[model samples]
Target: MSSYEENYLARRPEYLCHMCGKCCRVVTTSIPYKELKKRSQKGEKGASDFLSLFEPYESIEVARKVDAAVVDNIINRLIDDGNYNEEEITFYCCKYLGDDNLCSRYHTRLTLCRHCPSSPWSIVPPGCGFEGWLFWQREQEKQKVRLLKEELIELELLKHRTSDSQMLDKIDSVQSKIRKNINLYKRYGSENW
Candidate 1:
């Protein structure tokens, strides 16, 4: 099964899309559009993949026409997140989305579109079908962080109690990477979670 399908089975029931197409019609990102464009120009893979499939709406009003609630939800979430600078947040829509809420180039849709809602925390339209899935994913993440915290404590104790410098160095490296991974959720208040 595809990773998305696997996630559906593992967490929520068989996933069912409401077909509002709000996700494809309106999308936003913490990454600014200008920076994405610059990175695409510089041949960055993620940026290039994004710009390849999605283009900016001619203006915010144009995006609003496509799905105002989705657009407004994204903007409001970004504002509330507190980590994002107001000007640095950006939104875009798939040019391939059709009036019937179908993808014009479904077979050839880019990976970014195919694998959208990249995480549980992705801000989607208010009533998207993935809402329950997202909530389950967040709870899964919290459990993971809790486990990592326990592991980190053990690693710290091992490092200090052992005189093997090489082993201690390895332990330190593992701890560092784990902390880095955890911090990705820190913006969601992982520290307090």
Candidate 2:
């Protein structure tokens, strides 16, 4: 589970979604849907889990017109990262969304759908109530990344002071370790963090 999911569940486990169905209308992934399907066919766990619950939008332009937030926030962010290829970015919607932006399976929604848009960087609708929450989540992640970088600098100094090769090697390994934590927020532009 993500730290956000764990912490939030510990504090507020009861699911309290606004039910805008905008999250249902706008789903995306770093990889193209075709590749996702291919990965699913190859028994990739993440691809299988996501595809089993969501279905791709039949018309990209139509989906864009229906809710430009996904296009603006998600697609544009991918473009800025130099990963722009409209065909490579697919939008999706939860198959369970019913009329008037309600979840058809409100009582037994998938856990993933329950905590959908698990982070602030997720492409939610413009007016979705989680806007402030998302901002706070991003700030938390940014701060964590900054702290990791700080520890990395200390590790760099420790490496120079150590004569033991094993200890020096541990410092290198820890740098990689810290980077793994930092990369979790790289999608939110944590490079500067």
Candidate 3:
């Protein structure tokens, strides 16, 4: 991971969690359940770790019944982001969640559970305590991408004003790095920003 990601993770406020258990009650992965199972069997750490604790609901309707707000929030966010696909979506619930909205295996919870809301772009349940924090984090990332894009434009101008092979090569290298940084947020619609 990049230092920026490391810093963001380090700064995440665990205290912000409301412990409402909505997130634990209803969660969805980007891939289908079958693919996730295949990946887990193949020893993919993320998939394996996720399935180690979470089991797929019989259907999305069942998941919504478990926690309608969270399920709806996730679906709405996916739709808004142009990433919704009913065929590939699969909701899962933690097998270890207790009736009191606490983890049955709190002490031994997997890293995936511990890292809930793992990124700024995580689609947390509506009214979640981390909602504001996640939004701010996302804005910070967008701003960083915007700044990098501006830098790329500056570099382009510099290239146009320079004829030296060594200087042009240096400009090209810097532009590549800046573009790579911006590309990191391409999925988040960084181009529109």
Candidate 4:
């Protein structure tokens, strides 16, 4: 992980949670339900662990009935990101969340549960404490990618100045690695940066 990512994990503000239970009451995954089940059957720990704790609501409307604001917040965010797909969206609720919004299995919850809002892109409820932090993390990531792109441009310039086969090969390898890092963020539109 980059230093930015390492710092993000290290500085996560778990204390900032409002304990409203909105996150536990309404949730969704990037992967659809059927794909998650397939990955679970394939012995993927993340898929199985998430499935073990969260049960899918019958439909989006059902999830809305549970918490209209949270549901609409997630839906609007997805739409704004151009990732809205009704067929792919499946809301879920954690079975361990008590009526009071506390985790009944807090002591024995899985790592997945313990790491709620794990990523900068994690879809959290409106008014979530992680909102500002996640946004900062995302900006950090974009800045990193932009720096890598600048490095790539300088590397390209170096290629024109070199005729040594060995040096050219090494530069190509470095460029490949840098490109792989940039490609990882293409879903977030890193190419534009």
TM for every model, in the order presented, reads 0.75, 0.75, 0.93, 0.88
Candidate 4 ranges beyond 4 A from true positions: 1-7
lDDT for each residue of candidate 3 in 27-65, tens digit (9 for 90 to 100): 998888889999989999999988888888888899888
TM-score attained by model 2: 0.75
| Candidate 4 residue pairs in clash (backbone atoms < 3 Å) | none
Q: Provide the lowest-lDDT 10-residue window in model 1.
A: 7-16
Candidate 2 C-alpha lDDT tens digits along 1-193? 7776676644432344576788777878888888888999999888898898788877678678878865677777677788778767778877777878888778887767766666556656677777667677778767878989899999988988889999988888989989898887776678876
Off-target runs (Cα >4 Å) in candidate 1 are 1-14, 83-86, 151-181
**Comparison by TM-score, 1 against 3, better one:** 3
lDDT of each residue in 68-129, candidate 1, tens digit only? 88877877777687655646655677777888998888888876766667677878788988
Candidates, ranked, lDDT: 4, 3, 1, 2
Span of ten consecutive residues with least summed lDDT in model 4:
1-10
Tens-digit lDDT track of model 4 for 126-169: 89888888998889989999899999999999999999999999
Model 4 lDDT at residue 54:
95
Off by over 4 Å in 2: 1-4, 8-16, 43-45, 155-176, 183-188
Candidate number with the higher lDDT (1 or 3): 3
The alpha-carbon deviation from the true structure for residue 109 of candidate 3, after best TM-score superposition, in angstroms, is 1.1
